[model samples]
Target: MLATGHADLVSVFLGSGTLTVAGQSDVDRKATRFDPARTTVNVTDAALRPAPGSPAYDFLGVPAGTPIHVIPQTFQPGVLWAGWNTEAIPRGALAGDSVDITLNQARGPGLVEVYLTGLDGPERVWSSRNPGPRTLRTAVPTHAHANWAFTAPGVYELEFVASATAASGAPLVSAPVRYVIVVGPLAAAPTRTTLDVAETVGGLRLTGRVSGGPAHLDGGVPTGWMEFHRHYADRDDVVDHVAVDGGSAVLPVPDEPDALGYTARFVPAFHDLVAPSESPTVANPRAPPGAIVVGVRDRYTAGDTITATALVTPAQPDHTISWWTRKGSTTTPRGTTGVLTITATTDLDGAELGYDLIDTKGNAVASARAVPLRVSPAPPPTSTSPTTGPTVGPSTTTTSGPGAPPTTTTEPCVATEVTRTVRPGEVEVVTDGHFDYGPVIEGGTLTARVKDDRQGTPTWRDPSGYVFHLTDTARTTPPAGSGYDFLGSGPVWTIPLTQRPGIPWIGWNTQHPSVLGAVTGDVTMTLESVNGPGKLAVYGQDPFGGVGDRYFGTVEGFPRSTAIPAGRSGVHVHGVWAFTAPGSYSVTFAFTTTANGRPLTTKSTLAFHIGPGDPAAARPASTVVDQVGRTPSGQECALGTRGLADTGASGDVLFGLIVAATLLIPLGLLLTNVATLAAARRRR
Candidate 1:
């Protein structure tokens, strides 16, 4: 989403070192960069007027004295002042201290011209009026405006590509960025459409959704027809036109083994001033039928922890994963996750462990895949048989096999292989899922868990086993703004406000069932601490896609608190989650809500593995651990504590406590240890 409005001067600017260009909007005396594609620059009908009678203006080809939509070089109050600038390109950053902005393409209702009207007459920098040069050279550290004259009124896409040679002799070229300009009256509400593909029983199902438009347009449910395009090695072919219903359209296509890719274009039905939008091309890869590949051991020792994982072919995170065990005709539910950890016992020797994969719409994709277990009794301890009555001496039991000395067998402490390591393309991560209180206390108390809504039936995931992977797709330079200055000059990894392939789409929600009911008033979320290689920042954007809220930033300060309204339905929000450097980061967030005149709070550490790294190896700096009895309630979390202390407990015992803590961490009362427990109690 981009910020929309008619500003004095929204310049097409480029970053010198990074070479990423953006629209710099100077609105309300503040400068901010917005995604030009999503931004709507409106040239009101009032901008329409007679062209200058000066002979020099004839170069515009609009015919002098004829009426046209012209945004003058000088500031216009009600009109949009659109122009290009190189002010962002610092000195000595480029080889020639300049860059060339080229007009790759222009499509609209009529001719377009960008020129400077000075003493030299009308100097044409770029014009669709003439079939001549389309490139304009501009020096670094330069700021200039030009007269923008449009022949007709409608939507116009000005494709701009900037290229220059870096100081290091590297060629710097930016991808063609289209600037969407709306000339004259608001004919259409700008819209953004997204396309997604999923494997179906027939072949492939292509789904497209038309979203985003000016809220004032009263553009009710967008009625549209989605044009599906299939790409070949040489050309793209229009496959079909499916009418969009309820803002979305779905087309079931037979698997094309020879097709290169697929894309969809949304053309809004006439009468609706919704702009047309296109989706990125989706690559076609030969994939087999969806099936769950269960990973487990054929045999296990009794009194052991069994860790089993299921990998679904053509991985779909939206699919519901259910682990089950069967002994005879009855099947018991084990868990719901890619990884299932359970204790092994002699009673479960003949039981079969398996899983079922269900689609998002409550449909079974695959089921009944299982493997029987063979659990044997654990080895008994060795004992010494004393001959006759032993004197007043303590004897050690020494058992020898053959001529070798006796060896003692010790059980493993920690179950190190429980959680599965998720990497890019392995699993679908709802990066922005709500770290919220569950609807009801399934265990003993209200705790916070990751509400995984990828599938129809949302599943609660243990934070310890859940990891948000940030792929290289999120690598980008921070735009110019005090809100983003904390990211520094280097390229940072960002989990964007919108979903990007491979990278997790991170955000938070206060949509828990208890939000409006039990959680009265607003929910206070605080960034307790961030432990990682570099600083982390969380921010949101306004309606126009400009920075809105700077909720929490490590570089700015620590323990910053923000309040989110928990209205009738609660709020679902997604923001830009940026990491200064690539590494594992544990961000702790505390959520407090008032229920029935009583205050309840829960804290969870969000584990983010930015860039390349084994997500499994990225452990939360602080973990919730059981603080009490031998048998953990498994629904508790440490309150008022940042980390768990090593209490000289065995690794196995600690691991169990960690698992137990995760099970009920969302709505349970947890304690790091006796000390932290006392501290929490005192605070209460």
Candidate 2:
């Protein structure tokens, strides 16, 4: 016999209840409250049940009421169900309308008893009465129906008889059902029930598993009447949906949020018997408040380390908790509450930490706060401190206190959408997760690409923290195509190919895609197998459009081979765009006569205009730089404005451009004298 009843109800916030899943959904969350492992009943044993005061607490640490069936009179004096009755029901059946009893079976029959108990207090009670012993004939010819019942509500106990005998009437133990009669205005309509959720560090799991004892009630246990739903206060995207598995519930650890919380929605909550509100407003807050306090014991300089105590507490200890540092969204906490020492590193521009609590039933509550994890600027080098008062000297150890170990909280780089401030001649970049740099550059296109073919396309990872772009020419519109172009993005596809077999270069020539990837392959070997043994192969794509199996050549500097032996590794190939005169250039790779398949070829890709490398050889003898921008010294950069430098020597200077000023005057004077002398001779 099992105990069945209701507990405190809970108000839920559905939108905030959603979570990110990295595993199976049918998984059960092991509750720390009661062990389901010990509840196994040996149906064959005459005496069966949990020993009194045993670790198993009334079906998951719950308080249940009355026995559903009992056996007062037994024919035999032998074995009973191998267990004791823990109910508070009366042992005898002399009761009137105030007591009720029942033994029901639509499909099968089991021995049962009915009785009652008196209350000691809200937490304790007493019962030792019976309605007499009776035998439940399981092997009887007509074992069709054994439905039993009694009249009224209080002063009675209910029990299920086991190992009952036909002769001498052996006796068994019993448990009482606690039934309180309601007569006040605040009394509920009997349809309302409290939903108290458990808080956890890992998250919640609500399976909608609805179970109750007295499985066969006056009209069979009302497992069907009960239903479960979610209430997401922050996530209002959807109103409701059907929960699964016998009203058993499952909630889980949510994914990192985009903001503080999701939109709100009111989904139906679950309950066996719905009780009315005691008060008109709302039930006693089923959930407790959560809090986290942060305080510093010492102040550390910028780029240094410091720490503070993180104290977290809740009204009741029903929820789980965890700590989290800021990322792009509100996330899980760092090892949930204790002392969290944060460092004063330069990366802590906008750091945050949060705590999450979960209930045994998988309900959750959370709280978080944001703070600046900034590094204090370093102290000035020289002490202006009254030199007159005392002789001053430079000291590196500037801080004083009871020395403590350094503390550092996680400090991530700016988020993907972050924008770094820029300078005229400098470009901005993210050095790491902790640094934003200002670097000087010339006219060079700096392109970058990052990939992890194994993990696939990831939204959480992007170049959000570092941004590089050119500044427009303040107010002057260009005469046309004279500036620069920036290309920054590419497709990072996550192709799960560990078990993927090599597809035919062309689909038609091969067998209908033989499933041989998991088999032995030349290079795709299995070194480990936690999840299906699979790996990513780093193979270069053919530059041409046609597909074919071909022999790719070896590195030019390495020993050449027509076909690589099994398990052979690949070598690196470096390419350069030559600065010689612009002409059609063709390069080739050789695998000797031993080469087997088709020639490894790629079409012409990279194309650009190339002028002279020397100033004198440049087609134009002179190109002027007038509105040249320069640093405060007005000195031209050695690399020049466009990263183009002027030839260093006289021979390298562009032709026809006058260099020495002394050689110019004589030539001008000679031309002027010739004109004057010609005019005088003509006049004579």
Candidate 3:
């Protein structure tokens, strides 16, 4: 039996979602092994780390359906998977059960099926891309001539063949295929798996592999899908989350769901997509046989409206959703912490809570997910008064109107993702060496702050720098600047036009720039040169507005025709004015190419600002008359009196002096007078 035996048992491993099958064939009858030079599989390059056709091939034991994931290297007919290799199963056969399946040298698309008859049902089966087109479905398959399967009793059989029967409208055909024994379960259960998670910008991605028991979640189970209403209440009311497309599932976490204090259980069975009047069979009463502990590690205060989200990417659409609350049997079977608000605010004191998230399609129960949330009291009021809290503040503690609950339109705080703003002078400019500018562009520097809302900076060159700055509410005027050619005498120069279509204009001998850059194209270079004593003036193509900076010109010479694209927005006009009453001035001739039958405008504002040595003589007589003025200082008023005559000859005054002197001299002789007076008294 051992000598006659051709098929045998091998190693077995577990996988989460898909399967693979590979083979080779030969036309030579004597060759023992199939030649890959002629054989074509869905893949080309072998396995990663271990190259194909080497000792690494046998050591790694490459199974079918594993994705060949490598960068740059081409993997034709992309299957989108990242890995390439599958696990194994075994069958009982005498000794040499090593049977090698034969495949063709060229690659062909086909269908694959795998089945284990006894213990349960088929393990996995799959097909290629959409069916090829027959003038109808370009996405449909073109060839379906082969079919394959794997069955090795206690061992597994893997088949890979292009079948003719797998066509959409085609009939089925018979072929020799094998099936593995399903009667006996594995001697030891596969190890359990765990999930590791982290928070990201908008969501979180959970990834990990199974450990003790292989990680498997089947939404295609025929029966026995759990529907949990409430544990310790009615098992019929409970329902499990479904896996719609493939093994991977997606769930959009609601922004307003309660957070913290929750657990999750994943029931491994199939359930209905539509709501059913009757409940399906429950494979495991405690569906999801596995448990994940969850709780809120973050908290918010009362009146705190929070927004949390989880972005899920599914192999396909149509996943399920369910919600949970805290109060429940088994404690672990709890749902979201309803005591906490969707925008949870703490009561008086700060506390932490969690929300129980449930997926309701296949067998996702309350025990499937956990969340951590913090319930913090609103920031304490600086005023310690009991009624000073935010909840009782002016914008809060409002009454509901007409059977409606009050709405909250405010949130606590979050970081804004705005780019920092630079000043206007930061506009990009040419630098000597080092790179300097906003990080948006590399190796470039800015000289002025940009108008950030997107208006680009205007450019200018010498001799044509008729730059425009807003003069008032409606007009723009020029200041002392560089856009002018040397003119022996004329009025201040205005912008020039290369061409002005629809309107005839005069041409001056020196008007056309002798050395303006090569004509951009066939252009009508408009020259606004004053003649017969006037200084600056001419007609242009600009209509209803000033010529913009995009100076347009044509290469064709005069009497030549050029196709003017279209538009009047660019500079294509000419103007002139005398400087008051000038001695010398300039004449600017702007260039413009035909624009929509008008003129194309380039900012090359060629102008003649030069004037005579004294332009004061150029002022109009009326302007000079307006300057007439009176003297700056007013006449002063004088106050004076006629001189008075001196009374030097006052006789009364001289006589009085003479008499007093005589009297005083006698008085000085008063002692003599007193002696005389005493003698006169004695005589009396």
lDDT tens per residue, model 1, 1-684: 211222323233435455766676542212345787666677767678776665556665666667788775543323454555454444567776667767777777778887653212345667764545467665543444456788877767777777778889998878777677777776667677778888777589899888865432223456669998775433347889999887888989998765656777888753334877777556555534444323355588998888776655456788888888888888899998877899999989999887888788988778745778889999999884211100000011111111233222232222111234433333223332223222222122345555433211233344555567676767887645534566688888876543333454445555443344455477788888888999987775432223546777787643387776554434444456778888878888787777657777777777787888676466623333222212122222321111222221222211111222123222121111100000000100
Every model's TM-score: 0.32, 0.15, 0.15
On the 0 to 100 scale, the lDDT of residue 121 in model 1 is 36
lDDT of 3 by residue, 312-368 (tens): 222112433333324323232222322222446443123222233345446544333
Candidate with best lDDT: 1
Runs of candidate 2 with Cα error greater than 4 angstroms are 1-128, 136-139, 142-151, 154-252, 255-684
| lDDT for 506 (candidate 1) | 46
Whole-model lDDT values for every prediction:
0.55, 0.20, 0.20
Query: How many backbone clashes does every candidate have?
Result: 16, 127, 153
Q: Cα RMSD to native, each candidate?
A: 29.4, 41.3, 44.4
Worst 10-residue stretch by lDDT in candidate 2? 504-513
Pitting candidate 1 against candidate 2, the one with the higher TM-score is 1
Predicted candidate 2, C-alpha RMSD:
41.3
**What lDDT tens digits, residue by residue, belong to model 2 across residues 587-665?**
2222111112212211111111122122112111111111121223333211111212221112111110111101112
In model 2, what lDDT does residue 566 have? 15
